[model samples]
Target: MSAFIPLSVPNFGEKEAARAAEAITSGWVSTSGARVGEFEQALADYVGMPRAVASNAGSSALHLAAMACGIRPGQEVIVPTLTFIAAVSPLTRYVGAEPVFIGCDDSWCIDPDAVEDFCANHCTLKEDGLYNNKTGAKVAALEVVHVFGNMADMPRLLDIARKYRLTLIEDATEALGTKYVSGPLSGKFAGTMGDVGCYSFNGNKIITTGAGGMLVSNHPDWAEHAKHLSTQAKSDMLQFFHDEVGYNYRMTNVQACLGLAQLERLEDFIATKIARYNQYKDALDGYHGLRILPFKTEAEGVRANHWFYSLYLGETDLDRDTVIAALQEQDIQTRPVWALIHEQADYPRNEAYHLEKAQDLRAHIVNLPCSTNLSEADCARVIDAVKALV
Candidate 1:
């Protein structure tokens, strides 16, 4: 049997090891080290943001964004149901905000039309904020996730946000290097275009800091405030003083050093991903209704990271589960896109608007192995296996 082709995994090289050793020798492996701030600055400069705050996890950065945006108890945030629960859950679990689930378009991202529809018909534009007519909660924010590294409809979404006075948050965890190639946001990056952009460095993401997250914003004060809140609001570090509620969400120097190494190679990693994606796409050739879903790339006026590729077998008899099981038999790893968050038992009462596309995508889409270091031979093997199954 050939070697197991696992799903997306970190591609740490000698540079990462060298950085790890450096962090160890510095004797400042904790949050207070200089590396943490350096990492934050590097990320901010990379993404064209004024400032960035590093956190222990991606979810922590999201929670900080929600809190910084002032999503209080009596408010609701429009979120996409097709995303990882972390995108919307932070609004619900951390801030006392409700989520009105929106469906995905062909882009597998929050449908801006549905959001506008909800806001126009079901919500009332009031003096201070937009209010949901039925629930009477202030519609405070709009959180959009760049699912599978595909760019969302930022132009229309931006117009909607401006019209409704919504705080637009970009969950750019999966879209680190994705940037617009054309349109009004021509040179803007996925996270940089929005008011607040949250990123993740999980092992499975385009790049890994082992486990860490960064939050960036053009509003430097928000980043500073988030940094203050992350370090337990240390009003007087030497005096052990605390003013408002805070969290222990700071990223350690060890993680930051690793992240710096990863960041340096981000563009190279993205190129690798793009190459493998094209290999799979050309090799598969859409037989039996099986084709890799296209990201909003050059043709669509965007330069996507191609972070993770989703195989569409919706019209194929092999189906999502069947393909997953068959690939597992060959020691290849794959998974379904995501369980619809609204369909989850925890969010039964929450509103999910027109999830027809999202539902169909969830039923038939299977994720393919997209590791940055995936070899040419491994790519061929995956393509061959899928073709044989079809």
Candidate 2:
């Protein structure tokens, strides 16, 4: 048997292991230590955010952001239906808030027009400057995801958020280095544009701290509040005191050591991923019954991290599962796109507005092997397998 090609995996060099070992040798392998502060500062600088707080995982970052944004019971948050459910799960679990599943466009991000339409048709404003839906429930916030490292239309989404007076939270877990070229936030990174943004350093991400995340915000209060809440809302840091409920969501010093090492090599990782993506594009071009999801560089002036290369099987009777299974049989791992969040049994039965595109992508999209360590030979094997299937 040949080497098994993984869908995505961490690329760790000597620097990462050496840093982890140094942290262990220093006897600061636990959560609280200088490595955590150093990692947070480094990440904040890289993402161009004023401040960032590290957490145990990306999901915890999202949960802390939700709580910090004042998400509460009886309020609604607008979220895309076509993302990993982790993006929406925190909103519901942390605040008892309801998630309104919005549709996605070709970019696999939320449709700004759909967001506006949902707000206009279903929601109205109350005297207290809050948005209330036709069902008389308030819509508190909007959580937009930069799906697969593609930049969502933030300018338009911001307009919609302002019109409805909803808090905007960007789920940039998959888009740590992605940025838009033209707009007020043109030079800004994905997670920095919103009221609060979350990033993941999961094993499969472009950068990894084994399992960690960061929450960043332009607002000082929000950043401070998130830090306070993530550390269990202890008002007095010098004493073991707590004023309100909090969580043990802090990232470990060992993970921070890894994060610092990974951050140093992020640009290289992104470059390698993009190069491989272009290779896949060239190799699979003009194949019938197979369409790669178009990455929009011109419209958004976006430089994506190209985290994962996804292909949309267009106009083919071929089933996605069959393609995935075929690749697995060849020891080349591939996976279908995430299940639509609205389709999950956990979410309430909310109104879905024009979710045709999301449904279509869900049924047909497959993610190919896109790790930074993938060599030219691996790319060729993946392209050959895909071409054979098509």
Off by over 4 Å in 2: 130-132
C-alpha positional error of residue 360 in candidate 1 after TM-score superposition, expressed in Å: 0.4
Worst 10 residues of 1 by lDDT: 283-292
Clashing pairs in 2: none
lDDT string for model 2 (3-36, tens) is 8999999999999999999999999998878999
> lDDT (CA) for every model shown?
0.90, 0.88
Global Cα lDDT for candidate 2: 0.88
lDDT of 1 by residue, 253-348 (tens): 999999999999999999999999999899875777787888886878999999998888877887689889999999999999889999775787
Question: How many residue pairs of model 1 clash at the backbone?
Answer: 0
* Per-model TM-score versus the true fold: 0.98, 0.97
Candidate 2 C-alpha error for residue 45, in Å: 0.8
